[model samples]
Target chain A: MTLSPEELKNFLIELIRTAETRLPVDVYEALKQAYEVEDNPIAKQHLGAILRNSELAAKLGKPICQDTGTPVFYAEMGADFPLRSEFYDIAREAVREATKLVPLRPNAVDPFKKKNTGDNTGRFVPWFEVEIVPGSDLKVTFVAKGGGSEAPSTLRMGLPIRGVRNVWETVLQAIVEAGPKPCPPVIVGVGVAALSDQAMALAKRAALLRPIGDRHPDPEIARLEEEMLKAVNELGIGVHGFGGKVTALDLHIEYAHRHPATYAVAVATNCWAMRRATGYITSEGKWEIISKHITG
Target chain B: MTNVYHLRTPLSEKDVRKLRVGDTVYLSGLIFTARDAAHRKILDLINHGEKLPFDPRGLAVYHVGPVVRRKNGEWEVIAAGPTTSARLEPVEHEFIAKTGVRMIIGKGGMGAKTAEACKKYGAVYAVFTGGAAVLAAQAIKRVVDVYWLDELGIPEAVWLFEVEEFGPLTVTIDATGKNLYDEILERAKRKAQEILSRLS
Candidate 1:
């Protein structure tokens, strides 16, 4: 059976609502753990406040952050899925509806005109990147990219001769410069090896995709993730950039093979409120929203 | 050491002068909101010899563009979290000097100039935990008025609010010219250099 356009739009609308209001369970748990162990009194209080804020937003049915963020959707659809032609339109429609219903701050502006779109829908907004999979099901991950976190993302080309350590150094420098700006304790997503644009994209996706505390499958990458997290936490930036024991809740590193000439490194940071959610649409058009902490 | 303060708005040099880096302050009474556009507009109004919509002496300016929802014909704050203050660095020193704003609330550290202005103007730079929008909104008692809503739009408008215990704000830059961020980054840079050397 083909997925109806109306069903797809409604599913996406619900998906946006849940993603905005709820903090994923895993993210919340990591934050709680950080709050429990944080030695600095100032940092500890900040964490407590964050947890309380999330609880309040959920209870009141409000957007978790005032900056509801730009809704970025990543979708994977089975090639056999019949709605390929209409999917993009439905996604944009869902976002427009969510902006009104959730009353998302009108965030989209015409860059050149400097005009607020009023509906949070503008040129190329509700950006979607799709990958066609081999299956018959549709999976979508929604990332609400906040201005504060996105402000600190960086892309740089490290000299090939300098090797992987250069990538690490760059990532460290970026995080240090970002210091308390991207909001802490933040999750760092490092994307290595791809070209500049692709590397940044991968880093952003990694920031939103990987569950907090989950490491890369490859042992080497996993080891790097562990090392980076330790180094970052040691920076003493702490929660909200006030000095603390836990500067970062976790570090995620994802890599792609690159041209032999350059090793491009990109770091994407997400604030303590890791605002993301994943939804699946079945062939029968059933909508399933999964936030690992909330559902799993 | 950290100190907690229950300070009211229309703050004086004496009130802000006592605040030091790392001190926690819960600001009460009136606070105004402004972002990039509102900042520029205020500057323009000052230049054109027009009176500001609100009094600036001893005012606490929060750098935010809040999401406000209308309920029962009145505006209610949905999420009123702080925005990055660094973006205001270009004009902030002048803003403080010209307007006499005694306290600045936002996330991210302001620059050296702003810190210097804080000292010279007897002001303080405080950080409200970023992303704690819902929590921040609860402190706001009500929206008193707004300016430049049609001109600069909702998020960029200058919104005046009466608030109570409106912060878990850390005074990152205190009136005595001490900046918490500068100190933290100094130690951070030194420590980072040591780590990088070991790695290399």
Candidate 2:
């Protein structure tokens, strides 16, 4: 059955508003852990304040950090879904309204002019990466990606010989260099594939899929994630890069077949305020809230 | 009560020399906001032997791009958090020398050349609190004037703020070669290693 535009729009608005204010469960857990291990009294104290802030924000239904971030939606639509056109348009409209309602710090600025749109919509805002599945339902994941962590994201083009060790080393170096800049303890997403841009995309996609502290399916990747975690924390760029044992809360790696001669590695860091939410729309046009973490 | 110093209009080498690390300075008068892009443009002007938009000598340059709020046709600063100062390392020394800026206010620590410039030029680099945007905004009582570099964009333009008491910053890179950020970073590294070993 076709979904009513109003129903879809309401759901989209709720999702956007919720994503604006809340920290995802996984991100909250990582921040808590970072607070426990932080050694520098000042940094540790600040982290504690941040934790309290997150908790309060979640409870109050307020945006966790000042930078509410650009709204991004990843949709898994079914071939049988009747209201395909209505879905995307509803989502975009919801984002535009939510930008003002949530008072989300207007992040989308005119890239060339660097002027704030004040509505958080500019060129290519609310980026959607869509995939069609077999079922008669649609699953959409909304991510509020912040700028602080996004600034330090890196992509490295390496020879095939570089292998996993190269990836580990490169990641560690990147984290060490990033130091307090990205506002750790961060969630690092590693994308490995043949194409550099594709790999970077995969890395970001990986960030949305995994829960905080979850490991990769492959034992090798899981092990590397652990090792890299330890190495990065060793840099002593603790919570907020002050000094701590929890520089990274989780490392999610997404890999694809690489060209025989080349390996492209991409790293995306998600800050402490990992604002993300997910919802599923069924064939009957009713939206199911799979997960939500909405703060004031 | 916190000691408040009313520093003069254009701070010179002599004025900067009197300042000490860890001393709180309540700068009145004029200061310019110059981040990555503005720095590049200012350096280009210096390179071309062209007149700069503002006098640099005895000037305080803040490394910030504030989110502005407009009310009744006047622009007010909302949150003016300091941008990463290290990004300006490429042309910091030259910018300081050519511009004759006496003080640099930013978050995080700058590099050795900046420290060297501060030492040689008798200037100081003050570090405002990172992530404390609201507090920074309070320091800005009014926007005296703005020279919009419309072509360069939000981050590129040098916006001048008339600050009431614009600082509670630690002098990380002082005129005497004492680098607080380096000390903090080194200590953090050692402490982090110890904690990581336990976790592993």
The lDDT values for all models are: 0.88, 0.72
Q: Which pairs of residues have clashing backbones in candidate 2?
A: A21-A63, A61-A295, A61-A296, A62-A295, A62-A296, A63-A296, A238-A244, B11-B58
The window of 10 residues in a row where model 1 chain B has the poorest summed lDDT is B186-195
Question: How big is the positional error of residue B193 in model 2, measured in Å on the Cα after superposition?
Answer: 14
CA shift of A27, model 2, Å = 2.4
lDDT of 1 by residue, B27-110 (tens): 999999989999899988998999997897888999999999889989999899999999999999989999899999999889
Mark the regions of model 2 whose C-alpha exceeds 4 Å error after superposition: A6-10, A52-70, A86-90, A104-123, A134-137, A281-296, B1-33, B37-62, B71-80, B94-108, B122-171, B178-200
Instruction: Provide the DockQ value for model 2.
Output: 0.15
Output per-candidate TM-scores for chain A, rounded to 2 decimals: 0.97, 0.94
Q: Which candidate is the best by DockQ?
A: 1
